[model samples]
Target: MGRVVTLGEIMLRLSTDSGVRIAQADNFCAHYGGGEANVAISLANFGHDVYFASKIPDGLGEGVVKHLNRYGVHTNFLLKGGSRLGTYYVEAGIGERAANVIYDRAGSSFAEMTESEWQKEELFNNVDIFHISGITPALSSSWKKTTISLIEAAKEAGCKISFDINYRGKLWSQKEAGETISEILPLVDYCSAGKLDALYLLGIPEATEQENELVYYYQEIRKKFPAISVLYSTKRTVVSASCNELIGTLWMDDHYYESQNHVINPIVDRVGAGDAFSGGVLHGILAQKSPQEMIDFATAASALKHTIHGDCNQFSEPEVNSFLLAGSGKINR
Candidate 1:
């Protein structure tokens, strides 16, 4: 396999215990999470050589780097020595309301990065694939400039680029997100996002259920951004806070492939499931698996994520395959 590089910020996630609010909690589980980093970590866990580029405060950054190294992610291109580490507080929610996230990322190292912070060769030197997300560009103006510079540099390096919409409402407004994403779409090779995210970034009305909105949205999105040759989407139907049917779909060369929805009985953690799916698909592609296998593996990986708490990329391939094989479909994997 070749090198895969993900460009983004890795924040220290402080998550409250189940049913506990951030203000009321005395203890929280600490973990590192970022859309690009999450995908990179998952890919590394699946045996791919992966690297992640992000900025962190010297001390906290060192810890994050060590953690990534433990996960087999190359941190050679990471930048350190900043004042503060970005953080987010997550409170697990049940029933009608979804999980809540509070950001404390302003003035963080990554957000303060200038265009020079993105050294092309350091990250994309030997990289075969480069992955980025909308979340990074939405962080701040400087980050937006860095994201664009990195993408252009990756293209010049002859590497494939994967873009995940990852539109976070809390990060920016819909109008600005749509405009910015529209501008960057032409530079991306492959793209993925949830239906709502695409709709938000593309300013399209929500498509009807019978229309298979993901395919419809992808078609519409590709029309404007012809360079995006491959598309992946995760379809979700929230049954309750603890239950949902999650499916993954892939669109490439004008064909659509769908995966069976794995019903999550009891959701342990909602974060990083999409990144897990992206990881599985990218892993399948690197392994040269058929589209069906890619979607199946990706779906299985995501289903397993919902069973584990705190961004579960520590999973192994045997674990994911076990979930796909056994009738139990539980998280033992």
Candidate 2:
């Protein structure tokens, strides 16, 4: 199995049920998730030797580690006793409404933690692929410094690095996001962007042709920072809180490849689909799949994630391949 390492924050996600607002909800379901943690869980479920490193707050950190362990994610790099587990309230939205989050992550242990020699050692010794996201730096300036240091160390160690520009407007400003991410993109091997993320994060000018739209930006991206080996973007049409359509594309070796359209109706939860996509492509790469296979499997895995609740895509490879092979999601009786 390939070894994958992810470092960032893990938080207690308290989500309202029945489409109720956080204020109106009398009860909520709890789960452990964050950008890096969610991606780690997805890789673990795919049978990778995955380690997730992050500092947890004092009281609830151990439980979160145990939870990650249950999913086959190694938690040896997880540190405890910072301040408190970060938390967010999720209010699921429906038709004509939008989802919203209220982050309470300031001063959380992981947010306050910085890069250490031990973390650099973990990257050199255990990582074939190292993954992190924009959410890590959004927490605090210390985290931004930590992420940059870790990226440099990972590059020096010859580990493939994946960076997801998961811009959280709730956590930081657009100008800050643009500036910080531009500095780090040179170290990223695989970069993921949403519809306009490239436009805002790296200042790529908008394009006129909506179909070949992203390819236009690709030229701009290469002109500015030519080191990134691959770029990915997933197009989504949100029909409702529980239903959507997704199309993923990849640009590498000077060509663009797009995946088949995936329609997700009545999605169980949409939180971790993108992370699942990241996990799938990383898994494909580690397994030596061709780029076409990688994007196909990654997009399919993401489509399947909409059927599962919580922030982790907890399905095995064969289960995902079943859908990819023949659109088969039937009971395996």
Structural similarity to truth (TM-score) of each candidate: 0.94, 0.95
Pairs of residues clashing in candidate 2: 242-267
Off by over 4 Å in 1: 204-211, 330-333
Identify the candidate with maximal TM-score. Answer: 2
Model 1 scores a TM of 0.94
Cα deviation at 128, candidate 2, in Å, is 1.2
Give one digit per residue, the lDDT tens place, for model 2 in 62-111.
Answer: 77978898899988888777778989878886776777888888778877
lDDT by candidate, in order shown? 0.83, 0.84
Q: Pick the candidate with the highest lDDT.
A: 2
Error of 1 at 177 (Å): 0.8
Error of 1 at 215 (Å): 2.4
